[model samples]
Structures are given as structure tokens and as C-alpha cells.
Target: MNERDILIVGGGIFGAAVAYELARHGLGERVLVLERLQPAAGATSRAAALLTMVRDDPGQIALARQTFRTMAELEQELGEDIGRRTVGALHAAPASHLAVLQARAEVAAAHGIASTWLDKAEALARAPWLAPESFDHAVFFPDECYVEPYLFATALLRAAIARGVRCEASEVKRVVVDTGRVWGVELADGRRRAASVIVNAAGAWANRLSVDLGLPLPMAPVRSQYWISEPAPIFPRDGAIVLLPAIRAYARPEVGALLFGIRERQPAVADARTLPADLAGFVFDPDDADGWANLAEGADELAPCFPALNTLGIAHYLTGPSNYTPDRQLVVGAAPMIAGLYVASGCNGSGISFAGGVGRLIGELIRGAAPFVDPQPSAPGRRGAFDPYAPDFLAACAAARAGKTSG
Candidate 1:
């Protein structure tokens, strides 16, 4: 049996971020990261990489601001281009979310997060890709940007490894619990590894891991799909990530092409045991081609304000799943039923934006240190026993089935 001070499962953004934090704190020698597949193969790889500083909540916005600051420094320190492009972001306000947007901008400004209300003409001047009459107002977060998610994941892991963090390609099928504490992990190869503390950064499989430990979790998966427009030299070169308020879509340029996607209005779930065999190197089928076609139409509908994005080509498309909580917050903190186990999953769709700060906070909590931010209400054990047939679970399952079409 191999022994480690801390064992982290799942090598996606969550695990990679935690490993980086442990290394940054000079604890890398005691850390172990076990991945069933290559790193960034899960939701991390498909993240839109939007760095929005103005969150719907005050605390989360602050946390995001801190994390973005840290990411900027890390990119510089590593001398790697993790694509931390601070091109800014625009939140179009439909009648439904106008007040919410106004309130959020105020909260962000009070905290020194660069945000302002932009009139239609000024906003359109900056991002000539939106429809002129699409939004009554735009809340611009100048500090919010985007990052190349795969690069961010790999760069963080590289830095951690350079600091002596150990990583292995092994599937952790079971968690060993004893006396109400996490004792170790059991791998599919029948190898048992012991750890003083266990961190379940296991993305979509988090709830299943909780059940295996006799501590059912309230988190489930939500499916969000995206598509990349074909290469076009005429697309807008410099503009904030544009959002269409009424249509629930956002579009940005990627490698001389445009990427667009729709946010799922509802949540979804699927059996964790049936995860795709290959996390990386997956492709989209022709039968599902129409699924992302409408995203472009939505983008075109908002084209008057963003003239540069009025017409574009289709480059490629992909699908990713996000872990959702009952309150639509994140699931963080120690497992109430398991004393030595902690989880930092269920970021909904904002995991990439929240990864850096979340890992640091969760790492501190696991080591009994004071957390940087007050943990939200979506704690892993906030909901009692899990029921697969419950209303929430059923909704998640249905969405998951509908989301199966992917790249």
C-alpha cells in the first residue's frame, strides 16, 4: 500500500487546482493526484473559460475577483501563456434581469471590481457584434476575461509537478471509510492507497463517491453544450465576451474562429457509472449537428450590436456537463458524515472561473485552517440522504439523457 498525506481523486480543473494550491503552500511532497484518464478530460476541457468578476452574489464575486488576480500572477510567474485575456465582458439585461444586473454591478463596484453601466451606443461601439436593440443596458465588467481552459489546467499541473506533487493514472473506484473517517482509496487495479485526508474533486462522479462512502450528496450534473464557428478573418478581433440577454447565449473568438453556446435553463443527471470511456479525443456525430446550429442563429439575432459577428462559419462544436446544487451555488466543505473527507465539486457551469479560489479554500478547510471566504449553502451534506427518484434527481437524469449528443 502506498501512503500519502493527502489523496485527491479526479484530474480535472478541480483536482488540478487543488494540487497547485498544495504545491504553492509547500505541501506538494505530501500530495497525490489520481486520475482515471488524462488531465482536463472532463468539464474542464470544455469550459468557456469566461472570467466574469460580477457574479450574481456578492461573496462569490469577491472570490472570483481574488481568483482572477491570482491567475494573472500565476500566468506571469510560470512564463506560460494560459490565455488570460482580459478583453472584458458585457451582461445584456433583458427586462427580467435588469435590476439584478444593476444591483450586481453596484455590489462589484463597491468591492473595487471594475464594473460600470454602459449605454447602448457605447456598449455597441466596443463590441460591434451585438444587436443594437437587443439590450436596454449593459453591465460591463472590464476586469473579467477568458482563459484557454486546457492550457490553464495543464500549466497548473506542470507547476505542481515541478514542486514534487505526485500524479498517477488510476481509477479510484471505491473510497475506504472507517470509524466515520476516510481511511484510503481502492483502485480498480485492486491497489489500496492510504491517505490522512481525502479530497473528492471528482467532477460529475462526486455524488457517487459520496454514496460509496455512506455519505450521499445533494449535487447532480447539468449538461451545457457549445459550438465553435468556422474560421473567419472578418470576425471581431477585440471585444468583450458578448452575452445575449433574451436568448441566453454568449460568443467569443477562438483561434481566428468564433465559439458560441447556450446555457441550459434546467439541470440534468445521469448514472455516474456510465461515464464515457474516453474523456479525451471524443467527437460529435452528424445526427446531433442540428443541436448547435441554433446557437449561431441566436448569435445572429443579436448581430446588430455586434456587427463583426453578424455572419460567421461553423468551425466545430462540443458538449460538457456541470455539477449543479439545489440552491444553484457550489458544493464545498467537509462531508458531515465522514470526518476526514472533503469535496469541492458542483460549480454548476462556473467551475473554471472559481477553480483557483475554491481549491485554496477547500484545502484550508481540510487542514483545519481558516477559510478565505465563508463557504456557501451548497455544502456536500447540506441535503440529507440521497434519493435517485427524487424530483431533483429525476430532472437531472432527464437532462443528462437529452444532453448525450456531443463532440
Candidate 2:
């Protein structure tokens, strides 16, 4: 029997970030991470990796801002470039939705996140790619940035490994709970491991693990689609991520091309216990080039401001599961009904943006330190059921709440 102080299931951004934070807080040698597949080979690798404070929910905005600071600190301490692009992001709102964006900007500014309103001409001036007629108004988030999700995940994993945290390629079949407290985990091979604490950061498989433990969880998996443009110079060389409120699409300048992806609401399930898992139905791998060619068609519709991307080249296309919640906010903190059990999943598609903050909060919870972000919206009990919300998560919590009921 392998004994450990803490056991972490899953090695995605959430798990890696938590492990890194735990090691930094002095639990490195005593923590064990279990990953059935290679690191970052799960939903974490498919993250859109955009970071912005333009959210309607106060809790999410706070968490995103705090995560931004965490990324800054990690960059300074590790001296490793996480591929952080500091170009500010522009959020364009359709004429009918201008009020919503304006109100969101005010909420963001109140949280110490600076934002400025840009007229259509100003937005076009900054992004000459726009087709010259895309929006009624825009909000410029000067501090918004983007990081390569996979690279960041690897950085956190490396940091954790350096601190003596051990990780193994093994699947966790079940969580062991006795007398309303978590004992540890049970593997598929009839092996049982004991730990003082169990952190379920399993991403899309979170709900299944909780169910195996006989605990209720309000998390589910929602498939999202994204496509990479073939190397092209038509995209902006240097600019912030461009998001259009009217269209559920975004484009960001990467190493040699533009990366575009959007969230779609679809219920999906797959074998959670499998290694090197295949996400067939849950992932929308379009068949023909035109399948993904039309992905950004909304750009021409809503973001006519950036005309450069209207005719970009077709690049490789991929899709993956993005764990979500009824409120679209993450499910963090200790399980209300299961003692000694904690969760850091249900991050939707924004796991990369919130990974740092999630790790810090989990570290605080484990070490009995004061948390910097409030853990209410992300609480497991925030919703009574697993309901799909919006792709723009922050603004969807209220609607998610309206559909909640006591479990």
C-alpha cells in the first residue's frame, strides 16, 4: 500500500496548478498525482487559453484577476516563458448589446481591473483587420492576455516535479469514502491507496468520481470546437485577442498563425477510467475543410471591425470536452457532504485562465491559510443540478442560478 498525505487525480491544468501550489506551500514530498494518460493530454490541452476580466460575475472577475497575478509571479520566479502575449484584448458588442458590454466594463473597473470604452472607429483603428463596420461599441482591456495552455500546464508540472511530488500513469477507478469522510482512492486493478486528503481535479470525469463516492456533484461535460488557421500573414502580427459579443467566436495571434475557437453547449460522456482516452463524440472533429472553414463566419457577421480574418486559410481543426457547471463557474472548495475531499474542476473552457488562482485557493484550503478569492460561486452546492450555461461564463451564472433547485 502506498501512503501519501494528499492524492490528486488527473494531471490537467487544474491538477498541475494545484500540485505546484501545494509543493510551493511545503507539501511537495507528501503529495502524489495520478494521471491515467500523459500530462496535458486531456481536456486541458484543448483549452482556448484566453485571459480577460470582462465578466459579468464578480466572483469570476476576481478569480481571473488573481490568476493573472499568479501567472506574473510564476513567470518571475521560474524565468520560463509561458508564451504569454501581453497584447490587450478587444470585446466588441453589437449595437443592440452595447449596454451589456458597457455595464460589464463598469463592473470590471470596480474590481480594480481597468477597462476603457472604444468607439467603432477606435476599435477599427487598433485592428485594421476589421472590415470597417463591426460594432456599436468596444471595451479595451489593456491588461488582458493569452498564454499557451499546454505550455503553462507543462511549466506547472515541471515546478511540481522539482519539488519532489511524485506522479504515476495510472487511472483512479473510484474514490474511497467511509463514514462521510474520504479515505483515499481505489484503482482499477483492485489496488487501494490511502491519503489524508483527496483532491478530485478530474475535469470532465469529475461528476463520475463524485457519483462513485455517492456524493452529489453539479458538474458535466460540454463539447467545444476550435480550429487553427494554416500559417498565414493575413492575421495581425501583434494584437490582443479579439472577441465579438454577438458571435461566439474569437481569434488570437499565435506563433505563426491565428487560433480560433468557440464554446458550444452539448451533453457528452466518455469512459473516465481509460488511459490515452479517445474523445470521439464529445469532440467535434469536423470532417471536411469546409466543416471548420465556416467556424469563424460569425466574424464577418458581428466583428466586421476585423476584416483580416474574413478569408483566412483553413488550418488543422480539433475539438475536446470542456467540463462545465450549471452556473458556468467552477466547483472548488471542500465537498460539502464528504469530509477530507476537495474538488478543483468544472472550469468550463477557461481552465487555463483560472488554473493559477484555483491552485492558490486549494493550497490555502489545504494549509489553512487565508484565501485571496471568495469560494462561493465555485462552491459545489452553488447549483443543485448539472445544467449547461453560456460560453461567456461570467455572464451566465445568474441564469444558471435561476434553474437551480435544492438537491
Candidate 3:
């Protein structure tokens, strides 16, 4: 059996970032990452990679700030550009949501993050393509940024590997536990790897792995889809990330085009356990007329801010599954009734912006050090009697994905 001090399942951004943090904190060669496929092949690759720091949730806001700072400095440390784009971000809302937007701006200011309120004319000046009256008010964070998700994740993993962390392209068949302690993991090829601690950052498949060990996690997988418009003169190459909370839609610049997504009123939930082992054959739902309809309506709402969206042709469409928790926060911390086991999953659509902080916090927890932020709200064990597979739980998750508050 191969022995490791810490074993992390999944090679998405969260797992890669954790490995980097562990190495940064002196764990070095003691860490091993087991990836079913290449890094960022899952939800991470499909993420919009928006790095907006202003959020309604304080915990998420804190995490986003930390992640942004960490990622800002990572390019220098790794000697590679993670594609950090400091194009700024604008969050706009209708009159009914003005209070919420204003409150979030205040929170951002309190955290020392610069944010300024803009009227319709000012917002139109900043983003001339916006429809003049799409939003009643808007808040712009000038220092907000984004990164290429796959590139950033791979860069982190490569940095970790350079610092002595090992990554294996192997599938974790199951986690081995005995006497209430994690032993390690059994690979699909009948090989066993021993480790004292295991971190399940398995993305959408996290709950499935937990259930296999009789420790079901409170998380569900929901489909997230986005569309990319063809290069159009109306879309600026350096446009700011524009968010319309009222419509549950967001748009950012992508290779001279506009990349956008809308949260469906009724999200499609998937059974992670039944997913095919080889994801190469997986096909996204191309006939999602309802999803497109929602996006069309969202475009109509955003047309006042971005008139070009109403006329632009969609060049491509991408879809993938993202995990969500009941309360819309990530599940990070030790698992209940399981010694030497930890989890950092259920990103709730903010994994890219939360990766650095989540990785650092999980590493600190493993090392018995103080976390930068309180982990109680996001603790995996906090959801007592929370059935992840229950209808209500799924509904709550759906609501969260749609940018609504639910528990």
C-alpha cells in the first residue's frame, strides 16, 4: 500500500487549492491528490470564473475577499499568469432590490473593499451597451476580478507538485474506514493507499462518496448552464462583470465575446451516484428550451443595461453540474462521527472565488491551527437531520442556486 500523510479526493479547484495550501504550510511531499480525470475537468472547468467580492452573505464575502487577495499574489509566486482579469464588476437591481444592493455595498465598504453606487446614467456611461433603465441602481466594485478557471486550478496543482505534492490520475473507488476513523482509500484498480487523514473535495460527487462510507453529506448536484455569444462589436473586450440579481443573470467578457448564465426557476437535479464513470460520453441537454426561455426573459430584463444581448447570436453553450447545500454555503470542516476525515464541498456556485480561503481554512483545521474565519456555519456536521436527498432539501438547494434565501 502507498502511504501518505494526507489524501485528497478530486482534482478540481478546491482540491488543487488545498494541496497548494498544505504545501505552502509546510506539508510538502506528505500530500497526495487523487483525480478521477485531469484537473478542472468537472464543475471547475464549467464555472464562469467570476471573482466578484460583494455578496449578500457575509461569510461568502469574506471568503471571496481572501481568495481574491491570495490569487492576486499567486501569479508572482507561481511564476505564471492565472489569467486574473481586473475588469471590475457591477451589481445592479430593480427598485424592489435596491435596499439589498445598498446593504451589500455597505458590507463591502466595511470590509475595506471599494464600492460605489451608480445611477442609471452613470452605469450606462460605464457600460454604454446597457439599456438606459434596466436597473434602478447599481454598485460597482472597481477592484473586482476573474480568472480562467481551468488555468488557475492547473497552475495551483502544478505549483503544489513543484513543492513536492503528488497527484495521481486514479479513480477513488471508495474511502476505507474502520472503527470510526478514516484509513485511506481504495482505488478502482484494486490498489489501496493508506493515509491518516482524508479530505473529500470531490465536487458534485462528494455526497455519493460520503454515502458509500455511511456518512451521507447534505449536498445535491444541480445543472448550471451558460451561453457564449459570438464576437460582436457591441460587446467590449474589457467589459466589467455585470450582475442582475433580480433576474438571476450575470455576464462577463470572454475572449472578445460575452459569456452569460441565468439560474433556472426550476433547476434540474442530478444523481451523482449514477453518473457514468467515463464522463467523455456525457452529453449536455441541448434541447433545454425552458432554460433558453429563462435566459431570453433575463435578456429582456437586462436589455435596458445590455441592449446588444437582445440581438447577439449565441456561439456556444456549455453545461455542467454544481453542488449546493441547503443554506447555500460551502460544507467545510470535519465530518461528524468520523475521525481524521474532512470535507470542503458544496460550493453553491462560488467555488472559484472561495477556493483560496476554503483551501487555507481546511489546511488550518487539519493542522490544528486557528481558521481565518469561523467555520461553524459551513461545518458539514451542522446539518442535523438534514437529508440531502429529501425533496425539501433539494428544493432549498434549488432556491439557493436561483439566488434566493432558503434553508
Candidate 4:
């Protein structure tokens, strides 16, 4: 048996970030990361990687701020450009959502984040691609940023490795638990690696691993699809990220093209256990015509804002599964029923934005240090032992994905 102080499962953004944070806190030599495949080969690589911070929830807003600050400092600290782009974000909604938008802006202000409200005319002036009179009000977060998620995650892993953190390419077959305490993990090769603590940051596959310990986590995997349009003359390469929450649609610049996605009224749920053992070849669902129609409807709503989308040619379609909790927040913190076990999953589609903060908080919990943000809302057992595979839980996860706000 190979022994270690801490073992983290999954090497997606959350896992990479947690590993980096543990190493940063001087646990480098004692930490180990087990990745089924290469890092970020799953949803992390497929994420749109938007980092908009203006949110209605105070807890999420604080974490967003912390993640933004941490990501800002990482380049200097690690001496690597993680492809962080401060392109800002423009969120627009109809007249009915004016109050909600105002409250969100207020939350941003309270967090010392810059948020400027723009009327239809001013909004159009800033973004000429917007259709005339398409939205009544809008708010722009100038400090909001994004990154290439895979690159960013890899950068964190690289820095952690520099500090002596070890990463192995191995699939965890099952967790080895004894008397309500996790002591190690059984790998696919029938090898046992001992660890005093285990962090489950497995993203969509989280519930499967937790089930091994009889921990019924309320997290499910739902498919999220997006389209990347070929470079059009009307699209701006450096334009602010555009979000139309009223229609559940968003778009951002991808290189010289436009990357856009829509939240279907009925989100598609996937059984994580049945998914490809290696997610490297995952692709968009061709039979999901309803999803494409939803995107068309969203484009129609934005015709007044982005007229070019009406005639754009989609260059590629990308689809990946993301984990969601019943309440659509991250699940982080120690497991109440099990000793030496922690969870950092159920990102609800904000894994990239929340990675730094979540990783830091998980590190704090493991080290018995005071956390910068409260962990109650994100407690792993907060909802108390529910069947994650139950019909109702799955339905709730789909609904949560459709209406996900912090993405």
C-alpha cells in the first residue's frame, strides 16, 4: 500500500485547484492527486469558462470575489499565463426583471465590485451588435473575467507539482473505508493507496464514488450544450460577454468567433455511471433538436441586440455533463457521517469561477484553520441523506441546471 496524508480524486478544475491550495498551504509532499485520465479531460475542458461575479446570493458573490482575486494573483505567483481575460460581462434582462437586476448590482457594489447599469441606448452604444430596443436594462461588470479552463487547471497542477505534489494517472475503483472512517482507496489495478483524508472533487462522477461509502449525496449530472459559430464580420473579438437571462442564453468571444449556449426548458440528465469510462471522446447529442430550437429562440430574442446570430453558421457543437445540487450551489466541506473524508463537488456549472475559493476553503477545512467563507450553505450533508439516483432528485437537478444563475 502506498501511503499519503491526503488523497484527492478527480483532476478537473476543482481537483486541480484543491491540490494547488493544499500544496500552497505547505502540504505538497503529503498530497497526492489521482486522475482517471489526463487532467481536465472532462467537463473542465469543455466549460465556457466565464467568470462573471455579480450574483444575487451573498455567499456565492463572496466566493466569486475570492476566486477572482486568487486567479489574478496566480499568474504572478506561478509565473505562468493561465489565459485570464478580463473581458467584462454584460447582463441584460427585460423590464420585469429590473428589480432583480438592481438587487444584483447592489450586491456587487457591496462586495466592492464595479457594476454599471446601462439603459437600452447606452447598452447598445457599448455593444453595437445588440439589437435596438432588445432589452430595457442592463448591468456591466467591468472587472469580470474568464480563462481557458483547461489551461488554468493545468497551470495550477503544474505549480502544485513544482511544490512537490504528486499526481498519478489511475482510476479509483472504490474507497476503502473502515468503521465509518476512510483510510485509503482501491485503484482499478487492485492496488491500495492509504490516506488519512480523501477529497472527492470528481465533478459529474462524484456521486458514484460517494456511494461506495454509503453517502447519498444529492448531486446529479446534466448535459449542457453549446455552439461555436464561425468567425463572422459582425462579431467583435474583444466584446464583453453577453448574457440574456430572460431567455436563458449567453455568448462570449472565442478567439475570433462567437461561443454561445442555451439552457433548455427541460435539461437532459445523464447517468454518470453509464457514461464513457474515458470522457475524451464525448460529443454533442445529435438527437437533441429541442435544445437547438431553444438556442434559436434565444437568438431570436437577441435579434435586436445581435443581428448577426440570425445568419451565423455554427462551426462546432460541444456538449458535456456538469454536476448540480438540489439548491444549485457547490457541495463543499467534510462529510458528517464519515471521518477523514471531504467533498468538493456539485459545482452547478460554476466550477471554473469558484475553483480557487472552493479549493482554498476545502484546504482550510482539512487543515483545521478558519475558512474565509462560511461552509454551511455548501455542507456535503446539508440536505441530509437523500437518494441521489431517485427520480425527484434527478428532476430537481435538471431544473436547477436550466435555471442555473451563477454559471
Q: Quote each prediction's TM-score.
A: 0.88, 0.86, 0.93, 0.94
lDDT score, candidate 4, position 246: 74
Q: TM-score of the candidate numbered 4?
A: 0.94
Q: Tens digits of per-residue lDDT for model 2 on 1-407? A: 34466999989999999999999877899889998888888887776688876676777776677678778877887898987887888877668877767776788778877788887777766565555555677888888888888888888888888898889988898898888888888998889888879899988777668865555556555554567767665566675577765655576776667776543332233233331354544433234323444454444453354454456665766667666565567889888777889999877567877888899898998888888888777887565443233233422432342232100
What is candidate 2's local distance difference test score?
0.71
Cα lDDT for residue 124, model 3?
62
The regions of model 4 sitting more than 4 angstroms off are: 1-3, 119-121, 281-286, 289-305
313-388 per-residue lDDT for model 1 (tens digits): 5567676667765566678778887777888887767788888888788778876788888875657777777774
lDDT of 3 by residue, 1-113 (tens): 34467999999999998999999888968999999888889889888888877776778777888787678668888777888889888887779988878787788888888
Name the candidate that leads on lDDT. 4
State residue 147's C-alpha deviation in candidate 4, in Å. Answer: 0.8
Worst 10 residues of 3 by lDDT: 281-290
| Candidate 1 segments exceeding 4 Å error | 1-3, 94-97, 264-269, 280-311, 388-391, 394-407
Model 4 lowest lDDT segment of ten: 282-291
Give the candidate order by descending lDDT.
Answer: 4, 3, 1, 2
Give the clash count for model 2. Answer: 7
List residue ranges in candidate 2 displaced over 4 A.
1-3, 119-121, 262-276, 280-310, 382-407
lDDT of 3 at 313: 79
User: Candidate 3: global Cα-lDDT?
Assistant: 0.81
